[model samples]
Target chain A: MSSCEFESLEKCLESHLPEAELTEVKHILFGKETKKLDLPSCALEAASERDFELKGYRFEAVQEQLRQPRRIRVGLIQHRIVLPTDAPILDQINAMHTRVGEIVEVAAMCGVNVVCFQETWTMPFAFCTREKEPWTEFAESAEEGNTTRFCQELAKKYNMVVVSPILEREELHGTLWNTAVVISNSGNVLGKSRKTHIPRIGDFNESTYYMEGNTGHTVFQTQFGKIAVNICYGRHHPLNWFMYSMNGAEIIFNPSATVGALSEPMWPIEARNAAIANHCFTCAINRVGTEHFKSEFTSGDGKKAHHDFGHFYGSSYVAAPDGSRTPGLSRTRDGLLVVEMDLNLNRQISDKWSFKMTGRYAEYAEELTKAVRHDFKPNIMKE
Target chain B: MSSCEFESLEKCLESHLPEAELTEVKHILFGKETKKLDLPSCALEAASERDFELKGYRFEAVQEQLRQPRRIRVGLIQHRIVLPTDAPILDQINAMHTRVGEIVEVAAMCGVNVVCFQETWTMPFAFCTREKEPWTEFAESAEEGNTTRFCQELAKKYNMVVVSPILEREELHGTLWNTAVVISNSGNVLGKSRKTHIPRIGDFNESTYYMEGNTGHTVFQTQFGKIAVNICYGRHHPLNWFMYSMNGAEIIFNPSATVGALSEPMWPIEARNAAIANHCFTCAINRVGTEHFKSEFTSGDGKKAHHDFGHFYGSSYVAAPDGSRTPGLSRTRDGLLVVEMDLNLNRQISDKWSFKMTGRYAEYAEELTKAVRHDFKPNIMKE
Candidate 1:
């Protein structure tokens, strides 16, 4: 086939390439190219071995013309849990496993190579008003934690990348950290990143529950494009987002557990802003469903006092690099939101905006570092 | 009167202090104080010329009890206008004056001390695609322009500080500028500011319509507070907003003709980001409604066609420095949005965020100059 025809075929194939289609295409193309054998003979032998039906299309002929490597189908699984804040921590973990397992199965059936969860998906928002026991019991060792083991089996079963957030416990330091563990399709732990900024305002008393994260901004070299995870509160700080983008992160996941009313106004603003500002597609997954937690309340008479639990409103969503939101998952319902996106759209947007090419990063660093100093006065007098 | 009774009266007089009703005991004591002041035998006799109304409570009595001046009610008028792309230049100008007059009347009824309009309120957004006729009819002089005369009359009738945006024509150089003129309550022109940055992408073809604004960032001192206007498209350049905030501008206005869809998503994000980043209250006024203009379109079938004018989704809003939208005006809406704000709130928010207190302006200046150079590269290697 001519190069122009090959290019057109590749583009057409990419348009509707499903997860399961990828594996079939890969096996047929690889076998034909490596063996230098007839495409029809290789396909018939491979199809028989795999018990696969060729359907109406001439699979053998189509395989003969294929030249480019088969692309993998990756799916993101962003979900929110609906558990009472006072429920047993173990129950929450088990519930997460069941739900995540179901999502993994669904993605696997669709032939997705990877599935990702939001930041700290297994626990209630303990930072929203510091309470002691929740932190003590919620923290778990990264390597041997129950959540990790569950994710491992799921990953191995589906043969997909399983990215999950957990309350990481440092055995030596006796402290907790907000972290994400990337388990390979083979169930091997690839690596993990600890959240950088620990917010300490409003309901976010993260500093009291755990120390600041140790890992700086980083990107993981997945089979897909270079991916990075910026935990919940870190999205508010521009420097953190910039670090990952400047390092060439094409797809960044911001798995968050924010609810409506308190931080909800900021929810629609932050992730989209980061996407546009950094020229990267960002998936901001917010936990759905309310978690009732008992808290002290004072009455109007100044004599009455009671304990109450407030509800957590959930509305998780994914924002494209061009600033359009995929139909957001219901804030009140438990469901999965799936979207088919062109990874190349990032390049198209970047070429148009040229934020990376035109961005003055050196100047930003100087201004940011100086902005943190208490005594550094602004030069208002100088025009 | 007892000190506790005097304190209650003081609290009641301070509007922002949270209004409270005096107890029966405190009322009795205050009545005694009023009686003591009213005694004819007392050396301090009431003037016969004084037309004081004693409805058991009076302004003089409240003033005497509270030593501090009453807080003035400041209102922010966020105005937006829909300019038809196909309409004649003079027709568009006439439409803007009528729309502005209606908004001014609304501001007067709301008891607003100052009504600030958006940047370049006179013309349709010609910057999107530069057509020369629009630039040819640019307002030649700020003082002698039609926009100025309209605004001056509105200011005189309403007794307000009217901020009007116009296309300033520089007669000597035959150049045009994006300028904002501040008119006093008595219709006297106070001062004017030229926009600093002219954006080049999307619909902002500012460079084609007018020369880059030459004046450095500065604020206009008004009776209400130190205020400044940063015209549309300037919000993207952080330094411009920083310069205004650093100049003791308690309140800054970002008046724009930006519509929804193409750049609308960026609208909600940029203004609030600027408010939080700079630690200043920002009022972002966007023109709403649709305009029709015929644009030549080249089709794939080789037929030339025309596209109708675009729609400007108006959602004018005010964002507090802490990034909170005021109660009623936060939503995306059209019409006159009246927000009663405490000027002192700016001080409170700035004190908390300390953007000015901690900002390192000198270091940023050095870095910005370096960044403008073509060869500067980011040092991403350093975490």
Candidate 2:
């Protein structure tokens, strides 16, 4: 066939070649006949180069290249505390300072730009079975408390963001607040967020000890990244994570003081979901070990004594934006977990997946937040 | 008092009471001298009522009750395919007597189980990309073909199980296999799940013509309690919605086709992580979407294509042990997804707070898997 005619015929075949015919054409073209086809010098040269072609059409190539530089190293200190409820309150506070300082030092050595400790890290879990004495002494002033100053100095020394949870002492009413403090690398106290939702279920009698946090969901701008904290029990509320992320928190930390029996299994899935849904990185640090205490007061459920000396199984971890987890640290041992991460990976995965971009957030907010009457039901079939 | 007795009294006061003052106790007890001292009687009565006293002599009551039971619903289905890849061969074989009949008539209605359809429910997805002419003919058997028979029958008769993806044969080898059949209660296929992960990174060149599935990860089991399907590509890797239980999932269906991402995503997380990590019901069905096309093919990546299509995303689901869905009909759409479930609030929320059972598995398995390797030097920590 003439060259021009051959080109037209090749295009025609390319457009309509059946599966069986394409196989035959491939056999014939790549067979001995490939040598016999006479060609224009330029066309022959081009054909000799390596490019994938079928009939006369070449396939297009697509490549995804990284656009930004994003790197971050994260460390989680999964601490275990067996607070002696009967032990003197001052002793308990001193023990926390010593133990937490050791972990902070270790995290600093690991080159972590930020280190997170579990909720209420400085006190024993006093909410499960509220005791009046523990509550009275456990509450500490946020600005001038010994724990806050100690952590601030550590942050200054290590040049890392230090997140510590304590029983925050409210000035006006003398009540306590379950609070998390985010300290900057320069020893400046960036901000503090109090626990919003107080749980009254199971042994979690939080309301008796502290009122809900007054500050709304807030994200702090830090040198490393915009960060936020969602204390224990707050993780269940999706809106909490959403609000913080929408305000531009690149990394959200959930530092919790909980045992394996109450929430360990949910750990692997929940934090990761938050990261994926919010398009942010998540670090969940949990306390391991058990605490035994005696209840000082009687309650409606009529529990005189509470002993959570059960294992605290510390499975601390970091969830990437794409829902993959870095290798989780141990729940058995008292140790430090460090992970090197790229801050850009969150943007890259979000750009490709487009969950938030494509999500119908406005509509959901309007529809979901409205009060559903007793008789209301969603019509799934309505197109 | 004697010196020995005085010293013993001093030690007792120092050890038992740290912050309490003797004056406060004496003032509180002085007025009760007129009343009879009945300490033993009070102690007996308190003990009988399950009340225990703390070190400070504060009375507290304890309630001992058996843990609540936890239950979840699950569903499963298995069906067959009728259309072979070769058209003339199919012409010789009557479609009425094929396996599709048993799926629509028996499996959909009488068996009425969690109706799982065979992979590539309509026409096979493997034909068009391969260089085979006769196989192209099989592509014409989609909507008006045997699939309609199953869809209509199950939609009307047994609307229990949610039917999975049903292939739709459009034209000659122009059919699409990565499709889902979501049948609602009124006997209509509500939506579809197009395969998202199209295997292109390996020997399987699934990108020749049929594009990758475009649907995002979504949950369908709504008030029916949350449930979702991670089709072939959806199963390849873990993503946000793949194993996420927003409220919670009674069942998760992973209908897969391939063995690796060329079918890998299909086999790995489809059954294992989708179930264990998520703590939901899960089922993995492989079509057994396998095909033997008589065509040699060139992959988009310049490799010789052997067998074009591996297997199909089969119909399988993982569900909570309880056969109950959150809240919906247990009817079959096309490929059945029937599950009998108890939707009691107690059963849904009765599990221990922290998936303790699930955490134990990760702990024991961590040694065997060695998922996190610590071989790399500390790049960021070095001065």
Candidate 3:
């Protein structure tokens, strides 16, 4: 078989003991009483037939007489590219559209009001191969992009807000950017926010394709709630998450495409820490499986040249404001994690933690201003 | 038995299944091949006789041809108050000094170049009581206080740097503050940095005693390495950690005294996350056992009044820049964790992660300057 058609799923998706052990351990952030929600047989059958994984969980706050619960169902979908990496761009996009459509249909059946897909869901994570020829061909307009149009259709059909992370090609400046388009439940494009941080380390030659985003931290006010997106590398910056929370975001989505070798250890940490720090619901979604590139690439480290970006290791999960979280999905399979969260918990945790009241932002502002100056010297107490 | 004299270790130290289960689970941040270090038998005997826990772990980095490894042994001590809350102030101070002296001796024997004690190590955590009589009497001069003098002697004896967090009574203004005094290996006081953030919620009536710290982020450049102290509530603020890192801290110590009901879940997360973000080694030290006050107090929550401040769970551990960590000490017992870390690993991981190169500090400085304004508006996009 040709390299494009040669599926080395076994070699790429090797399950080490640590990963299995981590999967079995229940984090203290999750409650002991947390149980799985029963889904319809048709949804289960769809996942079973397509060989994808489906997980559902519910988080409840203590009953309060002060406010009615603002419960919403959030759906996070992490999936593999439908076709081989060497396929035609349009054909690959179409195949991915079909795969995501099936998952969103299952989410709709489960009463999801808001759904989000992995980073650049319509294309394979080809940034590792850094060749600008066919990879840049995948960039399209954010407003009229084929991916956004498809997501808008699904959003209106299910009356769900869809957050679609994509590679955007600006027509005027001829510049490309990593962006997330937020389509409201009415199928109107609410807004788009680009990835705040572009990673340059490892096999992630993302800077070769796009630079830092220009659009500031934006919270999309939807029928479901105030949501924001911290696409991919933005997850590494706590300030990115803090700025969104400061903007009144109740839920933040982190659509990421990271391999297991470079980021698996940090996968469960950054987003969950953000949820705790910001007092908001955070959904972390990553694409599954490995995609072999047509050309070999080197990661700059003194290692053998390779054709793949290592395994994506999809283990998407949801973390709550109180630090509680749902168990993650499969590390080796495409999966959908449906989380039922009470928005009241956000305020409850905020009141309990009171990090906002005592944050001392003014002091940090003054310090940061001084720190950014050209003549800046660190506050190091030396001998 | 009187509540003050009663050491209900069995009842207050009860280990639920989840806590035990969490203890058993080896976090993915720690390497699988990490093994225990062989310490002098006298130190082990001291711990065995005193019934406190002692754990030692070593972390190594890949040998580089360019530079010799900068290896340093760090000791973190977490212990219960040596006497009853109602005991005379000087007597209690002496008792705590004796207890910590024993631990420091053991640490010195283990070749610990730098050793740190838990927050307010010389006194009971009496902020919950909010009674200003004997509790406030524990406050002393950060420079010449008995606690500082004691720690200075220890530093001189072992030729080790000592970090002692204490409640300070500033002589000039007669104002009190929570401070960490850094003592040089030569038994001289280098400097002091106060707690950046003061918590107002929960049973902590700390504001009634002391306000926020005035000293900026201070990194003490010792004979061993540059270190900073992010005392207690400062752990919750990511900016505090960032500033310390920006000041070029190699190791940041978070000496905290917090109870289980309000903060047990967050204990393992904040410092570890800071270590990952800042590319430094973080040593988290929390005191053990429950301290019952002489008088009852009510946390602003609508619960009944209580005489104790819940259990101060002691799960002290060390987190490296690469996200690998050592197993934490026991939750129920007084403990010391000695970590042998190669300081060169900090630069190596920083080179690998490249967060500093990509971090847009100037952009954030401008954003924060605007954010702290009176008429500042969050960059929120609405419908």
**Most TM-score-accurate candidate:** 3
Fnat for each model: 0.08, 0.01, 0.51
Which of 1 and 3 is the better model by DockQ?
Answer: 3
lDDT tens digits, residue span B1-383, model 3:
22223222212222222343222123333433245788999989988987788889987887999999999999999999989999998999999999999989889989999999999999999998878898889999999988899989999999999999999999899899999999999999999999999988767858899989999898999989999999998888888898899888999999999875446557767888888888899999999888888788898778999998787878788988887777778767788889999999898988888777677878887887787787887777666
Candidate 1 at B285: error in angstroms?
Answer: 2.4
Specify the CAPRI tier of model 2: incorrect
CA-only RMSD, every prediction = 17.0, 24.9, 5.2
Give the whole-model CA lDDT for all candidates, comma-separated.
0.57, 0.50, 0.83
DockQ of each: 0.05, 0.02, 0.36
List model 1 lDDT by residue over B143-249, tens digit each: 77788888889888978877887888878788888888878777888777787666655444467778656655667777666678888767654555666776567
Off by over 4 Å in 2: A1-68, A173-175, A211-216, A237-243, A276-279, A296-306, A369-377, A380-383, B1-74, B78-120, B123-146, B154-164, B167-317, B321-340, B345-383
lDDT of 2 by residue, A203-309 (tens): 66577788767675567777777778888776655455655666567888898876533344345545665776667888887776666666433333455543553
Residues A19-86, candidate 1, lDDT per residue (tens digit)? Answer: 44533322211111111112244434533443322111100111223343233444454454545666
What i-RMS does every model get? 21.0, 30.2, 7.6
User: What would the per-residue lDDT of candidate 3 be over residues A1-383, giving only the tens digit for each residue?
Assistant: 22222222212222222343222222333423345777788888888887788889888877789888888999999998889989988999999999999999999988899999999888989888878989888998999989889999999999999999999999899899999999998998999999988887876758889989988888888877899999988887888888888778999999999875446667777888889888898999988888998899898888999998787878788988787777778767889988898889898888888777778888888888888788889888865
